[model samples]
Target: QCIIDNVVDLKVQAAITSIVSATLAKAKLLCQDVSARGALVSCPAGYKPTGCACGMGCGSWDIRTDSTCHCQCAGIDWTAARCCKIGV
Candidate 1:
């Protein structure tokens, strides 16, 4: 009975792993970098901002409308965004 239960558990685990592998194989995380000469930068169409960076030694930043990166520091030289999307 114990051996049978172990075999069943192994089969279940294999099925779960197969499903996960197939899902991961079909999904791709695509990323890009976008930068601008001002305090704000926007990700390209169909992309969402994952993170932000600012020039002039500034670390204060936020995302606007889920697409644009806005730097909060004064006299900022540039702003950049790491954008990503899921693709097949």
Candidate 2:
């Protein structure tokens, strides 16, 4: 009984740790994205800044040369986006 209880406690701790780590990583990525966008917005025209590629279909809008702009919804249908069906 004692051994089982210890194992269960360890499993709970591991799950909590994993969730915290994942949340931190996501926050960090969001911060970086905001910073990059701010820099792009502040830059003047013809000024080139390099950063992550646009996620949507706006590939022509060069991140290096153009100001910061989010990808349009027309490009990718994220609403219909799916990961995996049941049995493929």
Candidate 3:
């Protein structure tokens, strides 16, 4: 049997930032591609994460009818508001 010493192997926040950035970048590329093709781009302007809820919260980025990403909080109805992506 072997034991391991507890040590900070990596900066979690920094890693998270990097991962998010890259993910957004890739998403942007995909959006650009769709837009370039003159296709109707849903949520062209992009939406921020907000208002999460255990009930229909999805706890993650959700696409509203207006085509926007929203992280709804507990008891916050995302359907209440629309993203309204411009130039879509």
Provide the overall lDDT of each model, using Cα atoms, as 2-decimal numbers.
0.95, 0.39, 0.38
- Every candidate's CA RMSD: 5.2, 13.8, 15.1
How do all the candidates rank in terms of TM-score, highest first? 1, 2, 3
- Among the numbered candidates, top lDDT falls to 1
Candidate 1 wrongly placed segments (more than 4 Å): 1-23
Task: Please give the lDDT score for candidate 3.
Answer: 0.38
**Tens digit of per-residue lDDT, candidate 3, span 1-88:** 3333322334666788899898766653221212111111234356422222223534544545654344445443433222222231
Q: Write the per-residue lDDT of candidate 1 for residues 6-88, one digit (tens) a residue.
A: 89899999999999999889999999999999999999999999999999889999999998999999999999999999997
Among the numbered candidates, top TM-score falls to: 1
lDDT of 2 by residue, 1-88 (tens): 4798889899999999999888766652111222232212223333333433343433433232244433333443221111111221
> Please, what is the TM-score per model?
0.73, 0.27, 0.23
Off by over 4 Å in 2: 1-4, 28-88
